[model samples]
Target: MLATLLGLDHLVIAVRDLDAAAAEWRALGFTVSPRGLHSPHIGSANHTMMFGEDYLELLGVVAPQPHNEALRAFLSAREGLERAAFTTTDAAAGVAALRARGLAATGPVDFSRPVPLPDGGGAEARFTVFHFPREEAPAGLRVFACQHHTRDAVWVPTLQSHPNGVTRILSALVATEDPAGAAAHLARLIEGTARRDGAFHRVATGPGRADIAFAPRAAIAALARCAEEALPLEGGAGMVLPTRKPRPPALASGTAIIFEEAA
Candidate 1:
């Protein structure tokens, strides 16, 4: 059986300073886990936050060796939630399918990370990640994914407490320059039902769903125009995620997850 495409695994933000960002998330209530450094085969060094089975990672550059041009470019863009990632069961097959759809991708490459086990020991799990190559003006918000080896561990977060009300990831907003083309490309790459409505495309999967929103990066300025509220951060981007009940911020990372009580 082909590895099933699971829901979102995690989201990563490429920040300017790992220490500062991790500190911000901790003050907000998340038990930001220990930070880790990844090498060549793995990629950049990262500080992580766990939220049940899902997580949010803050990645930054330490050295420029083995240099990844893409990662370097993202860092140059200066601070913000950088990448949105989905989880899959099989990396190899997933990449193949994506290619068949005409989207250029990389990896299914062997990816591994060590997690601190509850028993005080650490265990390493292997996985794969497939990513869109360039962060072009047209594909800045391009989609990517991860597939992990399931050996059963005591890390991650409890699904019940996920902050996003994400009943199954209704969809995500991907702002890209070529909304129409990106939507069409995604429609073919993801083996799911999709419908386009102007600049937004809704993608539906068996147990998960997501919306890809296309817009130029310049549009972030509009978001800044919103009224400012007293958020946890002294001065940073913030928003509330409404849920069925009032709960503390589910998890914290560079981009903290906010929860709201259902109205």
Candidate 2:
């Protein structure tokens, strides 16, 4: 009983200053959403960049607490891609499936936050999240399954358009100490298989069929066009974006986002 992959939900980049991070992304031609605060208990806030079905979340601590201590520690160390979230239609069932596969999983925790509507009204965007055990993930990255209760509240059409001409996230690159082992773990989690591509291990999924590449730490630097000294040894190293035209990759919040011409 392997867990099914329902495609990517959203990727999170944790930052110290939310406004500054949002501005940085805006300068890079992304249409960042207005800042939204999480529930008081969660003590976090975010600005989202919606890209049709998939999105990117720039998250920051609004008020720190014991619950968010891990997030705080991540921000304290550095700002970058911290989490890779996959979409799941039924988070509780997803958790159960993973547990049956002998994988450690926690939560189908329900949470919601108010989102402002275009007509000056507001709606609560609800979610049930299934979290993977930290030990199972490659270092510096957290993987989880997210089930959205109010999809309309988050994927507003106006937020999908970007000035940079980016249409979709084509792939994500993960740098790991053991690429083969990590790739195998990902394959099992997604209930899909992995294949070797040079020194990289690749997994493909969803309607868009985006690729997830697991590569050695040294190889990731070269692929991202960043110096080895600057890139983190583990976690999300880069993303492949299919754009209307060719554009240079941008390094934001310590992640390399490469842009490619759409077919």
Candidate 3:
């Protein structure tokens, strides 16, 4: 049987300075988690901000290794929402299904990191992940799948509270030269469909899941009145979060985060 495509797992922001990025997130009213170091092969580390079912991660390469060459390359070009991961229960099967569909989805790679707790104890958060080739992704986007083996270690109760009152992601945006084509391609990559509303190509993931949209990078740049190259793919790497109260817009790594009041 073909592996089913689950909803979004988390969004990753590739940063040059791990601690500074985490600090910025904290200052933005998020309750950030302590840093976690990945295996040497991966050569990366991260800090996370949990939001109930999903979360956001600030990823940085701490040690150079073969496995993290792509991540290093991403950091060289820019820093922002570098990758987006979808949830999957069976990563091995997910790869096979992608291959059967003629997509070159890579391994169910296993990795883990130590999660520190407030009670002077720690746990390990393990995961099996697979990747879709960059060619299959739309412009300025990288997509992957992740299967969490230890969910509690990640969604710890103490880290769930955010002073900003943000509860969940409402939508994610992608900018491409050809949004119509990109939207269709994105839907196809994630085993979904897309519908066009004006310049936006919207893909509804599911109930309680963030909606994804693709638009023209040039148009977004024009509307923002900034140089096209000023932002990553014309500010395509943006997300909407519903907060309990209004907060001033936050900007980091050229990505502007606009928080809105909860409905």
Candidate 4:
């Protein structure tokens, strides 16, 4: 049985230089936040350029020439949005469902470690993640997710400063040639409904939850322009849902996110 997954969390845009890409986000009016170095575990270091509770994480290889294989593969794809993240209640069960669908999938990988605290003490923050193996999903549609041990309050500081009009992620705009097939496959794995709308496939879960719209070449190109800087990818390009409001200037090149909240 497929485990119950909650909603969307974050999205990743693969860039050539983390610093350069982060700079673009800063130029667009957000108080870009700190960088998190997740080494020895995820194989690459990333700096998050924050906006409200959501963020645009600039990820790159920081080690030797072409340092990490996974990072290299993502960067080599060249200039575009890379992956979309979904929130799940059970990472282990999510993995099992993907495998049952015949897609190459991996663990509810854990990220729990002790880090120095401000009080001169150490604390542990735990997390879980899962991903769709490259061999199975198309280059661009690779799906992965992360869940932190911290409460929504402790970890989501960006939300406090988020402007009034902004709300949670409504949906992601994914560009895939096989919209119908992708939607069908995803519907089986996720707790949502997928519908074919011309060349795009729109997928969404509960009300006020995340939605993903899969488009083709032209649409993808149109959305890529919204990115502060392109972070080439192996698959087609598109936008992640619930962009920061006043909307990042970088997103000017993409489609506007539309949705309504419960009264």
Q: Which candidate leads in lDDT?
A: 2
- State each model's CA lDDT, in order: 0.52, 0.81, 0.79, 0.55
Per-model tally of clashing residue pairs: 10, 0, 0, 9
For model 3 the local lDDT of residue 17 reads 93
Which pairs, if any, clash in model 4?
A: 78-232, 79-231, 79-232, 80-231, 80-232, 140-235, 171-211, 172-211, 226-250
lDDT of 4 at 43: 57
- Between candidates 2 and 4, the one scoring higher on lDDT is 2
**TM-scores, all models, native as reference:** 0.69, 0.93, 0.93, 0.72
> Residues 119-142, candidate 3, lDDT per residue (tens digit)?
999999999999998677666678
Ranking by lDDT, best first? 2, 3, 4, 1
Model 1 spans with C-alpha error above 4 angstroms: 1-4, 65-67, 135-139, 151-154, 157-171, 176-182, 195-201, 205-258
Task: Give the worst 10-residue stretch by lDDT in candidate 4.
Answer: 252-261
Which has the higher lDDT value, candidate number 1 or candidate number 2?
A: 2
